[model samples]
Target: MKFGVLLDDHLFPEWRFYYLDYNELKRQLKVRTAANPQGKFAEQDEAAFVEILERELEKVASFRALKSDELERRVAHAQAAVDSILSSSDKPNETRMRAVEDELNKIATEMTELSKFVRLNYTGFMKILKKHDKHAGFQLKPTFMVRLAHRPFYKEGDRSVDSLVIRLSRLFDIVRTGGIRPPAVLPGGASQNFVRHTTKYWVHPDNITEVKLIILKYLPVLVFSSKGGKEFDPAITSIYLDNDAFELYLGRLEKTEGAEAIRIRWYGNMDQQEIFIERKTHREDWTGETSVKSRFAIKEKYVNGFLSGTYTMDKTIAKLRDRKQKSDKELDEMATLSREIQLSMLKRKLHPMDFLGYGFDHEEDIVRFPYAVLEVKLQNQAGSESPKWVTELINSHLVEEVPKFSKFIHGVATLIESRVTMLPFWLPQMDKDIRKEAPKRPPTALDLPSSSKRHLSVSPSVEVIIDRPSSVASTSRPNGPVSERTPLLARQEEDEEEDDDEQEQQKGKKSSDKRFPWRSLFASGSGTSLHIGAGGSAHPNAFLNSMIARENAGRTLQQQKRIVLPVRVEPKVFFANERTFLSWLHFCIVLGGLALGLLNFGDYVGQISGLIFTVVAMIFMIYALFLYQWRAHKIRNRDAAPYDDRFGPTVLV
Candidate 1:
């Protein structure tokens, strides 16, 4: 059967145009054989590959069906033998039982091996089918069916078959969605290859919290979340390479914009397989042009060899050439630059200048926002260095600016501080400016323990150990000097501290009690609430219950506490109070009149409207009565003026 058009029409309609003929495939196989005698597929033609694939698939199916049936039969037979022996009236035979158990054990071991064999068979067939499918643009019928077909024969809840499908689905999702991109569009178009930007400041690590708070609003776009939901702001280790002459380091120190720094930076650990080698250059003359950073990754395995002067450029180029995934042009560009870096290291005798580490968190959908620290670095091909957005952001307190900050310089100074006599001649002035501008403690002087310290050796030839301070050494003391009285003294000190803490807590509790007026709210007095009659006293419980009920008094206590009209209130405030009650009275009368009018003349307005008017009238009358009582009490006590307003008028729309 010519499987060509039948499957190709459904799977890949475009395959017919580019599909290789059988003769062409045979010719390619011959050519490969001539080139490499022992290489895979060097001698085999297309027919041999197809035959092998078919035979493999057949073997997998036949073995699974036949072996599974045989295993089941053997296990069942062993079980039957044991059952027969046990059911018999004769005495149980130990030898027969042992033989039956041995047979059962052998079946179980074969079952495990069969399961693995079946899994491997499926995996191998799928892999081969996929490769051929890609070229032919048509998958093999049985292989495709095996993958897509629903397995009704498997036992319920058997997830063994489901795992492969789930894995494929996840891989598809990642390939479809996961790619490097900017969260938002840059000033220029998307085609820009490089963006130049400089650090306004490398913030003090002590102010990390403050800096985070400042940039909280911008973080939605600036930070990426890991699978564990942590904002990935990991410290990236950068090893700066410099020659013995210190020309690059000197130029950078002197603020020469043209000077460039070459470095390799990686996150977390140095044992990673991929690390970026970058050449960062700056230009001061170009307006708004801050810096240009070009970067590429090399294998981690090559890093040690390159540092030891064993790895050559030819080897690097050969590795690039072997990568079939990359294009010829890409390989050439990467190799050329790699060759230059390796050659420069050899000729100039480049050595490790410093190890710089900085944390960078970027906003989501980051197409390319490459910076070692929290500062922004723009890579625009146009070399546009205008930072209007950045400036506004800093001004808005999204981020604190650190002027003329370079991680390379900071790392060098901090690492070799004890060994070096004075700060670089130019650096002292910068340091003085920083100190003068902000006279706060900087975290640059942290005393880290030797075991946990992130150290960068200055030379590849020898490892340098920077000794930690005595304070740091003291903090990590594993075994303290023991004395007979030590445990007793420690217990005594702990007990004293606990007692002091308890006393402080008690003092605080007492002070809190005096701070708020709990007595005034629950107090039972004449001035505290409305009275039922002249010289009447009400209990606090009855008053609270009356307030909650908000209705006519039912109990004797509530009835006695119910407020009535009082005659001997202050006159000036009394008249104002009367006027306020009259206004509420007028409102109630107006609402009552409206309800009556709606009932008499507006039959067309509907029953719901008339009902609503009646309800409003009843509510207003009740509110007027409550206000009259509340105001009369306030006036009688002179607790608040009659003209004083507490609650606003309720307006119903």
Candidate 2:
């Protein structure tokens, strides 16, 4: 039989057979099987399995047909309630909101119950088919349909079933849609006996988007509302607990099997009120097919006291220790956790090591469907990594090898590196000095070359113009090819008779004879050299090196002239500069705009006060701007000088 077609055919078929009880149904099936001895299901095993499955299917079909009208009515009513909440023109009152939430929760609970019944019967029938037909690959785990008795959602407080109801409803909705809209909202409160086996992969930021796409295609969202259902990674904060000697940190670093990392974890920013203090303990089973991770949660608020060595787990431990009252399977585990926490506090001198933050995203296949149910079994490698749904993510070209990333260790190391020498090896090292200034412009042929001259002097004013040779100059004319001949220097006439005497004296001096001393322009005296290199290129390296040297020397001279001040003056002057700028802005706005409007401000005391404040604010703002740059320059150049703060403006009001 084609199982898919058969399931679809009988999905909503009318219930033709009805019996009072299970025994009656079994008797009827037995009699029918005995009469049709040579029929398809005459064999004892086949008959028994088919009979039991048929009974389950019949019960579901009959129940649905009897309650179909009532179910429809309830659904419509619930939808109307939801619509009322969503379509409100103004914010609904708390009472009305609660009523609507309750109605939705009721509908969700009913739907989950219905789905559970259908799934149970479906699995049973499939298992029987696989047993009878060799070709049928429908062997499935038959679900035992046992409805859990309703209880309080929390041990204390409001204790409403709204949270669980909402979760079940959302999950059913996902199954109905075949996971088209992934449920992103997380189930509120702690999950009792929750086991978390995590495998972390460090991927490049550039590849995060692509990796997310692959994850979305293959794995269902772990939470119901991650980033408001728009597929953005969540921010996680973990306050890690440790001791003075960092025993836990060392154990983790050494890869100790039962080393526990205790932390208070919360999703989103620090504003999250719902927090969980958990101790994550991992152990590898014998077969190693599964790495067992046991997590225990404590009160979130106890984290501070725990670090301070004032908190005790006496109350909780007492509850778990009551073996006669409640022998929970997790009681021992909880007790162990309690003992461990206390021992660490007493023996290790435990304290809060660091509060670290990181962005986290999980990769897993968590969705289930009726026809095609997939459970990915992960085989552990030699190391700490666990099985992930998208194996491509773990061994992909986009990411490096699995990194030894511990948030606690890294955070502690960052704050006090002298204590923790073993830093995380994944971080890349960077060079200490990186060029911050714009690159110096390359020298052109027009630049004057500097000659070697140790001693130099300059007149108050000096001008040197170097033009290309006559041949090169003519080539620059309208109708000529460009001349390539290089020109060294051009002659100049001086008004002072001292020039004649200086020239006569230089004739005898050997220092003035060798090539033009370009360095002389930047002599010890007050003088400026305007070198007009109007022509051809010289030896490429010579003039370029000279220009660079000249630039450096000039910079050095300016540095010598600057006055430095104490580091405290930097911020003071910076604020003063800001104030001056704001004062100028005030002057422009109030005087420029207000005075232009020609309001009769002179007649009012308020106007007079406004004018006074504006003037005062502007004066300070202007003084601030000037003082900031001036102080910064002096400080940078290493010149120690007192900073001027006398004229600093005070508030007019």
Candidate 3:
């Protein structure tokens, strides 16, 4: 299950030298294996080596004219001089020894310096990896509470600290249809441009975004770091728009083509400053030959060659559809390069699949526009074979919705190349609003085609886009069944009419022997709700018709009884309890989030997003507690008849 394919890879053998040096250090000077010779080589070793070389050179000088016995005698003298230095009597001269030691130390220092140059460059990578994990999760403050305590004694905010950083998660496609190339063709032929590096938009606080670039031997593509991410590294509220994809969009401005430093208000603070990011800096030199005849001439030649070439891809959707078509031997050679191009595009935009490798070990069908290289497997009609339409009949059962001939492949290639060259120049205001809340997901084949200058709708795909803010909002309804809301308002109006009819029928029931009067004295206490106790102290006499009861109670029995009894309520105090539970949850969530930080070691940012959810869960629990308490109070105080069987769980108020 290959996620992408590869082809036409190029490399320089000179770069191999860096790898060789790194491997050597891994073997020799690595901390685990080597013993520390320390500073002696900086001084002593250099002086000793130089002195021995000098002695050997002098012996060669004497060989020109000396007798054999004389030469032997000179060698003997040199050996003695070396031996005497090593077996010196008493303390050696401090001046002489210090100079020699210093020279040796110099040599050792030189060796260390040389090693640094030899290692391959992963300059930024080493800084991030070795110093600190770039994607660690946050931890909250600790909490303490005694057992059986009524409340956790701390300000709610003390335990409710959220992470300072927002973790980006997997970017899902905001819009998708089919292929990376727009369903259109490039304006010119294949030779018009070879766009190695390009960018479509730039994020800024105000209008006038800038795109900068640097050319690499291999293309130095600009990846909008924020927009493209995997599921694990979702763009949270801080970075992404509405939890969709985001990027530090840096691209070329139509007016300003030169390099100049521009101030753009970036999203995060200094540590996370992602604004004013660079796009491709250089502009292609436009050739003087802008004639249509010249453009078509090269295109015709390409068509002729492609028709005969083995690498020609045939089929309408052959742009990217069902791309694993080469034989196993060819595929093994081509897969890596194809995958690299796809991954590069993902990074330049906002992304999702894991760049370290695919986000996971499974194949996901990604319908993104690769950087303008669609495979076409073209097969020419044989000279002695059956008729052309008969060959077509052999493939008759298969619907040729996607064209498979030479002409179709040429169109597909042209379309992709054009889109890449004309990377969208987004409206500054639109881009700003998009940056504020674009969507957690990344750009996809289905997103509004930037080349949406033509029709709104097309078969198999729609070129519909929000040209105005109103259009964006209006299209949202019925874009996917949103018109259902209008009927709900109508239903509410009908319900109001039914309530009027029911009101008159319930009016005619009267009291029998028992009297219940409240509207007289209080004037507004009409619903029979009465509270006769203060902090649980008073209640009515239970007896009826006895002399003592008659004297104490009112004559008509509608009045309150004078002889009162103590009344009490089973107290439910949970507001304080609810608060305490929240405090505990906050503590656990903070620590649990940080504990989850272990995943920061992974290549993608999505793993850190899991920490954010813990805090959200704690918040939701607190909200639910309020709902429960409100419902409990509602059950306790609702209206009910005296001594009725249906009346249950009422508090004496």
Residue-wise lDDT of candidate 1 within 359-428, one digit each (tens)?
4221110110011135554333354433333444345322344455555554444333333322343232
The order of the candidates by lDDT, greatest first, is: 1, 2, 3
- Residues 1-653, candidate 2, lDDT per residue (tens digit)? 23233333333223223211333433444455456645334455454655565555556555644444455566556556545654664443445545544454444434333332343333323333333342222222232111100110111111122233333344333222333354355523334343433434433222322333333222233442224655332344456678767777766654444667776666554455455556655332322333343445555677566556577666666765664544565666666766666676668776665432223211110010001001223433346343232353445543333234444554454334335534444321110111122113222111211111111122101111111112101111121111111111101001111222245544543243232222222111110111112222211234334444654566444334311111222345445655765765666566545543433455576566566656655565566567667765554333457755554444322
lDDT of 3 at 293: 11
- Give the Cα RMSD of candidate 2: 41.9
Error of 2 at 87 (Å): 18
Could you tell me the TM-score of candidate 2? Answer: 0.32
Segments of candidate 1 deviating more than 4 angstroms: 1-193, 202-207, 214-216, 220-233, 284-291, 313-323, 354-374, 379-389, 396-400, 414-653
Q: Stretches of candidate 3 above 4 Å error?
A: 1-248, 252-339, 342-653
Top model by lDDT, which number? 1
Evaluated at residue 140, the lDDT of candidate 2 is 22
